[model samples]
Target chain A: MHFEYQVDGGNFSNAGVASSQFKKILKQLNVDPGLIKRIVVALYEAEVNIVAHAYRGIIKIDVNIDKVRIALIDEGPGIPDISKAMEAGFSTASPKVREMGFGAGMGLQNIRNNVDQLDIESVVGKGTKVEFEVNLG
Target chain B: MLVSELKEKLNLKVFGGNSGLNREITGGYTSDLLSDVMGFADQGKLWITLQTHRNVMAIASLKDLSAILLVKGQQPDADMLELAEEEGIAVLGSDENSFEVSGKVFNSLMQKS
Candidate 1:
């Protein structure tokens, strides 16, 4: 199954909409509970990253019988240093975002921790593309 | 323990989501960071935090949390309460701080175990 969701940046209230919708599909497909939990964590974190930092984003989820692939591609101020951004407690988010208990710099690291394979690519002035996959097998 | 049981024991105020009052509480996690809770909170846990936004309800619903107890007498935003009701995850409030209420919830869960 293939699903795509659009994310509006700086819209805190709608941050998790994509993840929630995908979760319901996963549940109906009888995806493993543990696997669903990990996907939910990674998806929500990535979803919020776009909402907090991007102009907008497109989330694509492809669930196969053997694996699930997700791609979050966003248009925003891209990361200058992906490695530094992955470090705990390093962030470029505004105080307003911080006040919401987000932008604590744990987003990418948390995403890395939850997915089986992950990739991130960015252009300094353009945006970021985060892709990851989980083996359902 | 059920959410309603904890509410009575701790004398918490129900902001909304009454339908989830009977949800089972397996334990509790206290954190203000959204990602921290998203990464660490287990299913059926009661989240104790001071962050009162609509996303808090999003997390609670996504995490399969039993309830959320707001700290420091904090009231949830209007959207937060509405989402809580829709998600059927009880949103409880407390005048106490996170530390105080976390300890209380800890004891309550421990007693049950």
Candidate 2:
């Protein structure tokens, strides 16, 4: 099964909608509880990244028999240094975003920790694409 | 302990999500960072934080948390109360700081266990 959600940048109010919906779908499909928990964490972090940094973004989720793949593509000021952004304490979020208890620099690390595979591609001044897959087996 | 029991035992004020007062609490986590709680908090735990935004309710619901206890007499945003009511995740409040509230909750849960 496949599903997609649009994320509005700078909108903290709608940040977790995709993750919540995806979690319901996973529950309906009877995915293992442990796997669902990991996927939800990765998905929520990816969703928040777009809300915090991108101009706009799309989250595409594809679920197969053995694994689930999530792709987050955003139009924004792309990460200039992927390596630095992947570091646990690096972030570019504005003070307003930080005030909401977000933008603590743990978003990408959380995604990496929860997913089995992670791939990221970015073009400075244009956009970024992050894809991750979790083994459901 | 059930959420209602904790609220009664701790004298917490109910801000919203009264429907979830009966939800069982398995553990507790205290953090002000949204991503930290999102990454580390487990299901059925009660989250203790000072954050009072609508997104806190989102995280509580997405995490399947039993409840959210606001420390230091913090109150939820208006929209946060609305979402908590809709999602049925209890929004609780206390006059104590996170440290005191967490210690009390820990002791309570330990006693039950």
Candidate 3:
């Protein structure tokens, strides 16, 4: 199964809706609970990053019998240093984003830690694409 | 231990979820950061955090957490409470700090075994 979600960056309240929907689909598909937990972690972190930092974005989840893949593409200020951004305590989020209990600089690292595979591509003047995969097997 | 016992021992307020709902909490994770909570929290465990944001509830639902306890007497926003009610996730509030609440919850689970 596949799902596409348009993340509205304007509303902080709606940020996790995409991940929530995908989690439900995974549960109904009888995905392993551990894999499902990892997917949820990665998905929500990626989604929160997009909403908190990006101007706007879309999150897509593709699931098969053997694995699940999530891609988050955002039209936000691209990270200048991918390596530093991957560090656990690096964040450029504004005060408002931090007020919502996110932007703690843990987003990228947390996503990397939870997923089986992680790929991040970004251009300073353009945007970012984060793709992660988890083997359901 | 079930959510009811946690509520009674902690003297927490049941801001959401059916009070009589029976669910066992095997462990606890407490953090204000959603990312850390996501990466560290175990499934079917209790989560204690200071955040009252909507995504907190969303994460709890995704994680299949046994319950959520808002520490330091914090109350989630109305929308957050509403969503928790809809998702059937137990929501509680306590006057204790996150550390205190987590320790108490941990001790409670340990005693039950």
Best by DockQ: 2
Cα lDDT computed for each candidate against the true fold? 0.94, 0.94, 0.84
Q: After superposition, how far is residue A102 of candidate 2 from its true place, in Å?
A: 0.6
Off by over 4 Å in 2: none
lDDT of 1 by residue, B1-113 (tens): 99999999999999999999999999999999999999999999999999999999999989999999999999999999999999999999999999999999999889988
Give me the TM-scores for chain A across all models, comma-separated.
0.98, 0.98, 0.95
Model 3, range A15-106, lDDT digits (tens) per residue?
A: 78888888888888888887878888888889888888888999888887777988999998898999999987888999888877788888
Q: How well does candidate 3 score on lDDT at residue B98? A: 83
Residue pairs in clash, model 2: none
Per-residue lDDT tens digits of candidate 3, residues B1-113?
88888788768899887742477888888788777777777778888888887788888887778888898989888988888888888889889888887888888888888
Q: Candidate 1: lDDT of B110?
A: 94
DockQ of the two-chain complex in candidate 3: 0.78
Query: Measured by TM-score, how close is model 2 to the native structure?
Result: 0.98
Candidates 1 and 3 compared: the better one by TM-score is 1
